[model samples]
Target: MTPARFAGVLSAAVTLGVAAACSDGGSPVDPGGCAADLTTGIAAYDLDGLDVHAVLPTSTSSCIVANADSHFVAVDPSAQPSGRLFVFLPGSAARARNYRKIAFAAARAGYPAIVLTYVNDLPVGVRCAFGTGDCYEEVRREIITGVDASSRLTVGPDDAIEGRLVHLLTAMESLDPGSGWSTFHDGASPRWDRISVAGHSQGGGHSLFLSRETTVFRATAYSSAGDLEPLSATPVPWLDGSWATPAERIGGFISEDDEVVSPSGAIAAWTRIGLDDFGGPVSVDDTAAPWAGARMLTTRAPPRNAGAVFTPHHGVTVVDGLTPLELDGAPTFGPVWAALSFPGS
Candidate 1:
């Protein structure tokens, strides 16, 4: 389904729910019900083979985190576990429930996936818009660890992105002792080496930022490059910093016609991180699966244009309603998701 149209499905899921078929009229099968946690507006999907659960951050900790209504955990028992978890972050102000399709796709591919709810109400660029040196890194540090590094915002440690992941896994381990979720975290810290990170828009930038903090299994970005300073249009200083994850292990997808963020600018940021050294991004539209074995990827798919109410092309690569869909209601970019977020190349 297109990302622009997913919202309509969500609103209807609140009311019609199981009674509703795919609102975009692409799927022939009737869904039994909405994906887990309808009150939080997870889209109606074929959840038959997946064990999906909505976890509130507060369900595991006393701190009330952002997007508390729809933190999701998905696993498909039918698939062989890859022994790694896929962690996803939503764009600024976007809800976690809206991203279950991708998470479910990761789960079906045999990775435990969580669409985390972290503090992302403000864009990282906005927070660092006019700051003194590399405020981009400082804001990301504050958000991830809840340290008072940037003067713009204060994220508490318990409410920090790292802390919330630890809490979620700790709670999940307690809920299902045999699931082996405990391997990703101990009581205190996340075993960053055991996790793969992916995100859309602001979440995409944060994913790369997280990769810098620790050695994640892999890093994938969708519809995102790092934040650009508005005036000069130059990338923030942190994009050129020392990264723990190598460029070869990093992969990403972006829209050629992204309206919200410049596609060339996005590629420039990726180049700054050395993604262009192995190979420049190949077009997912013209190229077949594996996309010539390139780590960086792009698509020529156009965004949904609804007269006066338009969805940005920036979201065409993932969600926000512009992502293309197959006739069976699966995202056309499913292969891209697997190639990027899967356990290894």
Candidate 2:
């Protein structure tokens, strides 16, 4: 997609007050790892054989406002002519940086990708401090009920989430110098072919939501159960009925022994996806190796819900139990990335 051709249609979209949706005047940080324009249409940047960049609604800013830095990452895979998109709400600067590496890998292997980084404000008092802690109901209630507080640190309304995402998309298509980083494929704004959404934990939930939106190609949900609290003996109502797409079309990656997210939940989610659910497990070995002093496991796909469960202690990879994939140097999950990298594979 050439910048000149994209500039034409993008010009009109920038007009109208829609371009001023950014809450803050701040610009998104490229971080040197990923490349792309943050405001208009998708800007394809070639890096290490990967086509990488950020895509968003034309008008944008850096803050977590209604339409601040909601961006997407686009990567072209070497193995294939097309690419994949990873969509999520940006949690922090660190995670965004790491995501660039993952995108590079996908692109190097002949797969282009996209990551959605939109702003979302968690309710105040909603402590996500402990890994063993569960706050499913509290969080769910918070979502449906807007937070009311004197200090002004409360949750927003129903459209609060999707509304903001749409604003970001609008800003991307708009033609505004201030809101300047939205991008799309084929140089046309908002091209939604072969894209996928992904996130970790809460972000994963957002990915699933976007999948149903039908604005992208497909969705990839990782390590996120809509209900975070540990389920009681009685079956709790899940959003199984409201899946954005058919269960089989959604890709889920979870650890079998994940304490944060129960394996039972993963299985249930898979069942919801039905027989057509894509990808398989890549088990990581938990047994200790003689020389390495740690057990090694392998994953056929990417592994989520492993950080807190397996590496709870931090800086060390454990191998006591095994999942489909193991995390060692340069983590690789053929199964998880399989669907995202190669949708029909």
The best candidate in terms of lDDT: 1
Where is the poorest 10-residue window by lDDT in model 1?
A: 25-34
TM-score of 1: 0.83
Scanning candidate 2 in windows of ten residues, the lowest lDDT window is: 287-296
Per-prediction TM-score to the true structure, in the order listed: 0.83, 0.53
**Could you tally the backbone clashes for each prediction?**
5, 82
On a 0 to 100 scale, what is the lDDT of residue 267 in model 2? 48
What tens-digit string does per-residue lDDT give for candidate 2 at 1-345?
458735653554434333223331222221111122343444545555443445443333322333334254444433554434334443222134335544554444444443454334552124433322334333433432233312323344312343334344444444322222343333212344454555655555555545544455655555544443343412134444454455545655555545445545654544553523332333433322221211112222323454544432111111212223335544444333544434444
Using TM-score as the measure, the top candidate is 1
Assess each prediction's global lDDT (C-alpha) against the native.
0.73, 0.40
